[model samples]
Target: MTKTSAVFPQPAPGSKPTPRVYTDEQKSMIEELRQYALSLLLPETDSYHPNERRWIEEPECPARYMRAAKWKLDDGKRRIKGTIEWRREYKPDLISAEHVKIENDSGKILLNGFDYDGRPIITMRVGRQNTQPSERQILHLIFCLERAIDYMPEGQDSMLILVDYKSATLKSNPSISTALKVLHILQDHYVERLGRAIVTNLPMLLNFFFKGIGPFLDPVTREKMKFNPNLHELIPDEHLEVDFGGKFDYEFDPDSYWEQICRHAGVNADGSRFEPEWKRTQMPQQEQEESPKPVDSETSSTAPDLVADDDDVESSRAPSVQLPRASKPVSVKGGSSGKEGVEVIGEEEPNVLVASA
Candidate 1:
């Protein structure tokens, strides 16, 4: 009896699954949602609470806010026009001992109160703190507050003048030296575009005061206020002189300058400069004379013959070969002569050979 052996099938090894691909419509929808989410939920803005006094994050936040605010303001109107009003209020002194308040059974009173009332009175004090407004926040607050006041008509002229004066003072003040240094640091360390935008927009903030809000100021006061001449220009011309040492003087022929710089650095601007002049240094006089000739097949074939003729002439002039003696006897009848001799033989007709020998 013959028995068949059992056969087993092997399982296939697992392969990696392919990533799912989204359709164009799905991708477009996803991008749209991402943009909307980014606009609405800016992480930088979300980090700061509304009540916080710091405005350093305003550079990213105010732009988004202004866009929305402006859209809302101009939705129904053809040209929305308005004016802004600003004013400076003296902060209450908080550092003096007299500024401190004590609460009594009848009322709250300053320690140095001239007259004390029996009614409840709250004391409010203000003073300079270690923390100051960020430059970005200061500009944002100025812009937003100006916009807010512009939307409203009350005290428009007065506020415009005040904002301009305040901005000018800030621009000229030495107190913000640290902030300016920080701005420079930011420019160096952060994305260059962002730093440049921030620096550039600082002037725009001033321009906004002078141009956008300046019109509302009283004619006499407007004449008194002067802006830095450079403030209005976005990018200065090459010939223009900026108050700072920085100037724009770009080379018209940068390639020429590059060549000169490379030369000064002890580097060849082009490879040909370092290459030996073969015509002047390495080439023989004969080679230089013959270098320009074109070598076709006829010329190339004749070149070997010319070289061989030169070699033959040189060999003939050499003292190595012994010449045959002219006085030697000659034999012409197919007979040998018993002396050193030369012989000549006549040609004969050719004979055919048989295949079988």
Candidate 2:
């Protein structure tokens, strides 16, 4: 198997690098688990996602599963078996771009850039979440995960997560059940796939949301989470966005980004799925309107309770993390380029999702 540069956060200058070493017994366990995985007769399906198949057969996969299962042979086998079953039932590979355009267009989650370690980065703008929590929302996240894996360089089995809480209010957070489902998918199905997680600009009240999901977080995954990390240390300045204190100047262009991601996923801007020779078509349009006025980040205060009980939903609806809107107007790049150009409003700005869901 191919190998990348020394594991990231390269050893401190003048310090000895402690490369990972597996004991002979651990190696044997991994070998046994690998054989067990290969011995399974998977149910015949129309097709499998390349990554899913890769996760089963790759040389590094067994070790990853064993690591996730804490080097227990039987537990590793069970984890692998469970993930295979989940993938078969979920068919995450079949999720179409048109089906998730609303969530994608919201720019709530994006797969972009790479960390210093070459792991693809997934940036989740919690503040931009506009839809109610639902299965589709989970699918959008899974879709992004599949795409992030696609971007992973060979020999690299993990990806980085950046949760941007800028302008996230208690109302913007997903329901607890939805968050738990997301955690279940990530921890149980996507074993050993998180390199690190950096949650930035989180508001004080959002702490409630984190606390709700805390118990369910895998120990390894929880340890990977870093609150308010210095972005420059993990991501190169060129790839890091200005919003996150890097030299890279990026404004989220919803239409262009959506179409680009759709095409990459073998689908058109419309709901049509196509193969190699598919032609690009014009995206549909609807009435467009400006979003609500921006809230001043420095002055706006966080809400009281982020994870309110169902009966206290009204109080939980208050906004939390507020970010100052961009001062200058930026041009919209895709279908609605005809507009005089909307001011870069708050996270609530509507860059319309044109596909019929």
TM-score of each: 0.15, 0.67
Give candidate 2's error at residue 236 in angstroms.
Answer: 0.1
lDDT of each: 0.20, 0.56
Give one digit per residue, the lDDT tens place, for model 2 in 1-357. 221111111111121212346789989998898888766745444234333554677766788889888777788999999987776566555454555556666677877666655677788877776665445566667778876765565556677778787887766766576566666777788787777767777677766666766777765766676676566666665556668866555566667566455444344332233431212222444332222222221222421111211111122121211111222222222331000111121222111110000
At residue 248, candidate 2 shows an lDDT of 51
How many residue-pair clashes does candidate 2 contain? 2
Model 1 per-residue lDDT tens digits across residues 1-357 = 111111101101111112324456544443443343234332444322221112212222222222223333232121111100011011000011111110011111101100000111111111101112333222212222222221221111111111111222232322323323323222221111110010111233333322333333332222323222232121212111122212322222323322222222112311111212322343455321111122222223321111000001222121111111212222111100000010111111111000000
Model 2 deviation from the true structure expressed as Cα RMSD, one decimal place:
16.7
The candidate scoring highest on TM-score is 2
How many clashing pairs in candidate 1?
Answer: 2
Per lDDT, the best of the predicted structures is 2
Clashing pairs in 1: 85-159, 86-159
